[model samples]
Target: MRVRKLTFAALAIATALSLTACNDEDLTGQADPSSTSTGSSAPDDAGSDGSGGSDEEGGKGTVAGTGSNENGEIGKCRTDELEITASDATIGGDTEGTVAVEFKNGAGRDCALAAYAGVDLGTDSGMISAERAGEPVDTTILKDGKSIFFGVTYPMNDSGGSGVRVTSLVVTPPDETKSVSIEWPGEATLPVTDGGGSSVKVGPMGSAGQGEG
Candidate 1:
């Protein structure tokens, strides 16, 4: 009878030990929710023209004009009503076309259009090319100026021929050559052609300043 009791006790002890081992195993080899990865491994999805890559991809925004320094402690100048007026552009049958570029001024100070403002053809990203137009525009600025115009080129629609995109219109006085940009109104609405006659405007692209909030 004692042996029977001992045998029953041993069986119970064995069952408890097995259960304890199982509990230990469950605790030690547990899968943790925090141990898993969560993110995508795909290629960076950028703008089709490879111009609209994210900040991580090294694309920020198009920079134009000098920054604002209202205090003038060697500060920058800013204007609220700098603008451009573009006429209908016609290209092809030649290596150029003609488009009129104008810089409309709304600043209180006298501002002239410099010789290096970019009137280019824009792409998927804010990439612009100096299309039919000639050199930098020359704005004739006076105090409370209005509009200044420059005539661009009339190039033929080559396969990779893009139309016209204006980067920036700037002004520099006689003493200083560093350009001060005229703020463009709205966004760039150019007509560009991919040398193959496939064309589109390069903008509504973002700028370096305030967010779209």
Candidate 2:
């Protein structure tokens, strides 16, 4: 009787094991056709490599839109800055008078002045000394003396045009956040030598030129 009981107990355990070894569907009901194979969860597919593609990437990377300016020179100093000072500076324009403007660079990168254009040495400060267009026009940095324009405001808008008299202008462009403005007064003298080789002297309106009436 003890041997039979022992055999019965072994049989019961084996039967339980066999039942558990069968498929889960067999234990419950019919297998769901639409159910995933292996009955495990599926993997996700956000697809993006998360590496943020390069600007010139053809397709492997996901490109994005960014803000940019055509005329903004706030970034690295452009090689063209020196050129603009010597000629048609969209930065500074228009001046009236025979005056000499010298530039002193304080630090940072190479740079020029952005000043008012067409500022006649004959006008008094109380009067509308000069007109400034949009923003001021910037001057170019040059190794030698630069021939540039100043103090005349135009129809458009820019940072390179501020119609105030400036002298001994010390421009510190190499600084991180540079502040561009006139520190001292710019003097206006009569034309001693014209680009056309004429001895044209400026007539002061009581306040523009040097001492004496």
lDDT of 2: 0.33
Model 2 lDDT tens row, 109-195: 434333332232232232222323345433334223233333221122222534333232222222224423333333332222223
Measured by lDDT, the strongest candidate is: 1
Per-residue error (Å), model 2, residue 145 = 14
Which segments of candidate 1 are over 4 A away from where they belong? Answer: 1-79, 89-95, 124-126, 131-139, 158-213
For each candidate, give its TM-score against the true structure: 0.32, 0.24
True-structure RMSD, every candidate: 22.7, 15.1
The lDDT of model 1 is 0.42
For candidate 2, which ten residues in a row score worst on lDDT? 204-213
